[model samples]
Target: MSDIDTYKQQGFGNSTGFGARPALLIVDLQVAFTDPQHLGGGNILAALNNTKSLLAVARQCGIPVAHSRNVFDSVDASVWCVKVKSLKDLTETAPASQIVEQVAPVPGECIVRKTKPSAFFETPLADWLHQKNVDTVIVAGCTTSGCVRASVVDCISHNFRTVVARDGVGDRALGPHEASLFDMAQKYADVLSCAEIAAHLRGALPG
Candidate 1:
């Protein structure tokens, strides 16, 4: 069997059933990755557009929206030094590390900054979602094979119903992106397009 098939055979993923109390979590879509010349850059424009659609629907349905961005301390080399090989010029206040303007978090949204891939790692996001009674988490963002995938797995491990926006998440490499999405769908999340997710949200909310 192929790697994805092997993963599924081993029960790495689960079904994509959504819950009544759902929230949205957008992963790292920072300027560094959006810009083609940056260390974190990729072809994620399509994912960004789909994520925008998901954002509009979440707002219309009164669902809580959360976002995560990677920020390292200026003087702290322990943050991402071990993970990222090319770690030069990646400071907390660096313009490249900021979320891209097109996908910027709005005023009322809760934005979480982390020094790691998993959104819940040393973050208040889990408690925040639990307090809000969120049973389902609609996920979006950049680099499907990295932060996005890690967040999905963490969400599942935390026992949250997870829905992955297929078009709303992108990768630096097409092969890895597709493989990650398939693996996530088979194991961690229910993978769907932005429109399907919006429709599902619309159906759950009252007029």
Candidate 2:
């Protein structure tokens, strides 16, 4: 059998189902990753486009939207930063660490500042979702192999139906991007394309 067919047969590509009133979670689509000139930068233009559509659809459906970014303190960064010797770089004051323009969080949207890969770790993400009464979470953004993947696992752990937009998340390496998506689909979350998510939002089953 072809590799693709073999994977499908093993349920490695099974689609995770969506649910009513899905909340949108956009993770770490920051300038550092989008600029191609900073640490962790990647080929992420296509991913951004996909996420733009997701954002529009979520707004059209009146769904709650939240965003996450990684920022550290200039004076005293998180322990992870100190341990990794990256404390001086990820300061909260750096514009490079901010979310990219195309998908920047609008005023009043919940923006969670994280010091680690998982959005829920040391952040208010879980309580915020609970407050919003979110049943499902549609996730989009960059570095699928890192923060995005971490966030997906945490989303599931929080008991939220997690949906990772397949094309809407990118990584510095194509291999990790593809491999991590496969891993997320197999155990952590539903990984779908923007089109698939749109269909679900429109009350249709995604292929």
Candidate 3:
């Protein structure tokens, strides 16, 4: 049996269909994670491009949107600084920590500044989404095996239905990218394509 067949037999890979309200979280699509020159490479560029249309749909749908950035601070540096020394340079004022122009946040969208993998970790993301009464979150961003995955786990842990944009997230390697997608789909969130998600956003789903 194939891996998916085994997972199916084990009762995994079930869908957690979309809910009434949804929010869009573009996680860590910063310059540091998009441009191959600075800690970025692989298919991240394509992921960014895919997310642009999703983001546009979210804005047009009047969905609550938030963007995350890895903002490092010397005084408040987390354990990650030692593990990934490059994170040290992504200081509060560093351009690398800034969101890429291709997917920059506009006014009224929450800016979630994080230092670790999960956007909701020690961040106000949960509260913000709660206030918006958001029941679902559509995730789109880079380093699929990293921040995006972490955020998806945390998002479901927070009791929100989570949907991952397959084409909207990328990693430094295809292996981890595909692995993360499968793992997440089997255990944590609904891993759907950007087109399907855009359809849901356009009023085509359980909402």
lDDT of 1 by residue, 1-207 (tens): 787678768876567689889999999888777666665445487888789878988988989999998777755556366768444355677887788777788877778888778898889999989989999999999789988999988998999999999999987778899888887888788999999999989998875
Quote the positional error of residue 95 for candidate 3 in Å.
1.1
Q: Estimate the TM-score for candidate 3.
A: 0.96
How far out, in Å, is residue 58 in model 3? 0.5
User: Model 1 residue 156 lDDT?
Assistant: 84
Tens-digit lDDT string for candidate 2 (79-191): 77766664346667788878878887887688998888898998998999889888899889878988899999989998888999999998888999999988888877887
**Candidate 3: which pairs clash?**
none
Reference-based lDDT, each prediction:
0.84, 0.82, 0.91
RMSD of each: 2.3, 3.4, 1.7
Q: Give residue 184's lDDT in candidate 3 (0 to 100).
A: 97
Q: Residues 57-134, candidate 3: write the lDDT tens digits.
A: 888888999999998887768788889989888888898889999888999999988888999999999999999999
Error of 2 at 47 (Å): 0.6
